[model samples]
Target: MQNSATIASDFAELPATASRGPLRIEYRWINDAAADTRADTRIAVFLHEGLGSIAMWRDWPQALCERLGMRGLVYSRPGYGLSTPRAHGVKWPVDFMAHQACDVLPALLDALDIDMPARQRTWLIGHSDGGSIALLYAARHAGALAGAVTIAPHVFVEDISVQSIAQTKQLYETTDLRNKLGRYHADVDSAFYGWNDIWLNPAFRQWSIVGELAAIREPLLAIQGHDDNYGTMAQIDTIAQHVPHARLVKLDACGHSPHRDVPDKLNDAIAAFIASQT
Candidate 1:
């Protein structure tokens, strides 16, 4: 028996649903032509941040897919978006992000039927926690990957990361944060605490995948903001140290989320990297 999420391409600018393992996943393909036989058609899978879903990504994936002329896939992981919410008593494990990378992502890809040239041309574009997941997936499945790009990814836990998340936890409780996030999730608490709790857990302070990055043979680009609120440049710097061939892009006047803060620059860098890699 295998664990996987199942969905086909050819969606009409709308999201679709599928089931992965015991969880139902909400996913959608962008600008995909089911019958297009162009040799250069590519696939870029977008992995959102810890508290992000397909809706939270807004039109960024569509914009990037158009910019790079590649098919794109976006999804909400378990306990996110319109997918099944986390059970009331269930708590995510310390290795939640790693499980997302090693287990959930692979299963989703298999179910999406990415066993074509897209498999070889596939690129993972991840942000924040998603960036870390992208790195782990590339390390574990380099042979099936073409390239990867990470934005503000955490290779290791940092004091500042914990501080900011803890602060946001307060916001989620005291402010309209939950109301704002509610627009993107079916169960805001499930989406919020599922990510928040594990990240702030004492056991997670030691969570780091820096050692496994050595196995990533695929072309990789790591991006970070000069003024990121979460992790520091050490995150991407460590990535460069581990994967010597990985390209590093440091953006000035940017914060944690580059796609939102500096979309033009991020898009250009992504387009250039993919062009150069291809």
Candidate 2:
């Protein structure tokens, strides 16, 4: 793992925010120095977890972009990172994640001028909540994406997930978890409640993307850890059952965050999957 000081230095020269209205998005680009200077390599847009921000991703995105010989876009959603804070006393609607998938992502893509004609090939690499957003985006914008790699994404709220979230709530209240998360989220409460309230909501408990999974025809790779406490292997299993052609990878002795827990193994698998698609 890259130390916080090193991560800070890498991001030190990044461009400052140009706007802070309805959405607070920051952007960065990575160019392949090793390639023939003229070619426009395809890009990978990384979406972080609910509590994650660009700063939290550290050097992983940079490392991946370098390894794949591609550019990368890493940003913070509204209410996280340096973006706009969530409205006070506002509770996210049950379909908040859907809104993010259908609205915010497209808006950000357009804002960054990433919607080029032949540049239609986009690779989405998302983690946890971001992973779910990636799936939803692929479901809606079918042919626009080359493929997606999702790690520990949830299609529905499992009992295990709820239980773990409940424990997280307790930890937040009684321990230093909030302070730890504060390092990532600009407004930790906003980020926490935005995600926590939705998952614990009665209506959201039954929320499932099984229908959407079937609609996704793009190449898909869903990865989960066998020892993940927040969700079971059944999440990816269900996706595979719905989208029979989707490939599934179950990592042994791993937890929810595969990229963080098993970086080399996860990167190798993702690289092979992307190559196979081409």
Candidate 3:
């Protein structure tokens, strides 16, 4: 099976005129199984970071999907990459992640004709903002997920995280970060500001999903780097404390991106966790 990221890159390498959808939501199949394959096979969905898109994931999703013998789906959220751009002047609400978890994701699945069984066994692999979104989804739609792997998820805002985000704002305004992000986002401002404004809002500082997590009964694997600049280990630690069967893995010499920073270890850990759930 090719990783979903590699498939996405190949799609991106195609002519710009290639039509996907209104939002250019490119959905690719990673496994070569027949369409009528048994539902017992796991399907992993890749959710990108705050600044990520389907293209930014490189070959990691594909590799992980193959390693786990699972089908994979990767898509750029609205306003990112080939996805449809958000309307001008539209701002994300404070509970944007909640909306994604409660609404957008389910709709996306429905559109793709992916039905959730009474006891579904799918996995969610989410990074950064996507990780938080995954947690919210798992909390509300517990029957839809068998396990989840979150890398560098933020449960609450920390002083360090705020400071780092402030620095990012400076970089976006005064440095090449904006130009760099433009490569992945059609509306860079929408993607950046939507995430930034929400996290920086005063009311958002009180945003914590620990209560929701406490209600999650599914297995979870929370991985974080000890040296992550954007968030602290406390994020995953908090998940472990709240979610009944949550497992925490702290990676050394890693940063906010465990899949990118420690691919082999991260993949092994995720594969093992998924296998145990099966």
Candidate 4:
């Protein structure tokens, strides 16, 4: 196994073989120290939050991959970062997360030539909406996944989520949140409204993947912050009930994003969990 010292970045174009049409995905690969000892088979994929892009993830994926000595992939979804923007007047559906989990993510892996065999050694590390997507994908594609680590994931809609989302929509209109997020997105509105609009939709309140999570059979680690404003302990707690083998960790004083709030502790916990599984 060769350990490199460079981070590779590029774009993968998906031909319109699926219903979502053609898309360009911007991705970054952190390969420095990727193949440590006999751990070359291990691969980590980082999925960002609802409004996150490759730029927004910054260096946390790289930091975690360095800690584990594994190759890591981080990418922007269709309507985020430098990837294709949402078409004008297109409103996201209530099941947008499902479409992302079922369609977009699989296509991305395929386009990158990550076959099912390789997926057996792949770990999906996701946060917020991305965390939910990771669970949804693992629910149906357990055979293709080694395991999953969800940070502040939601299995069901809650009143708290609605309130936060509503506040965010207001911030986007009345404040400089749009300009600030523009630093990470080529089309800020595409990334923001696409996620914000869907979450605030009245129909989305009924969207729940709690029942679907029972399909996940791989090792799972569910982590959440004790003081998260968007969702509460019920999120990760529900995951533990369905996935009896899932390990749970609640970080005190940590908010919605544990990686940002407590990077060192989070990294150690994840590395230990993966080591124990192996």
**TM-score for each model:** 0.91, 0.90, 0.88, 0.94
Query: Better model by TM-score, 2 or 3?
Result: 2
Residue-level lDDT of model 2, residues 1-278, one tens digit each, is: 23333433222112323432356565555444523553556778899987788888877887787777777778787767766668767777777778778878887777666665423677999998899999999899888878899999999889999899888888988999999989877788988888787788888888888788898889999999999998998899998998888899899879988878888888888888888988
Task: Please count the clashing residue pairs in each candidate, in the order shown.
Answer: 0, 0, 2, 0
lDDT of 4 by residue, 123-149 (tens): 999999999999999998869989999
Candidate 2, residue 122: lDDT: 79
**Candidate 2: segments with Cα more than 4 A from true spot:** 1-21, 31-38
Between candidates 1 and 3, the one scoring higher on TM-score is 1
lDDT of 3 by residue, 1-278 (tens): 44444453322221122322233454555664622476567788888898888777878887887788777777777667766666667777777788767766676776676777612767889999899988998889867887788989988888888888888998999999999989878788877887777778788888778788887777888989998999998899889888858988888999888888999999988888777777
TM-score of 1: 0.91
Segments in model 3 whose C-alpha atoms lie over 4 Å from true places: 1-26, 33-39
Q: Pick the candidate with the highest lDDT.
A: 4
Whole-model lDDT per candidate:
0.85, 0.79, 0.78, 0.88
Candidates 2 and 4: which is better by lDDT? 4
Top-scoring candidate (TM-score): 4
Which residue pairs clash in candidate 1?
A: none
Ten residues in a row with the worst lDDT in model 2?
7-16
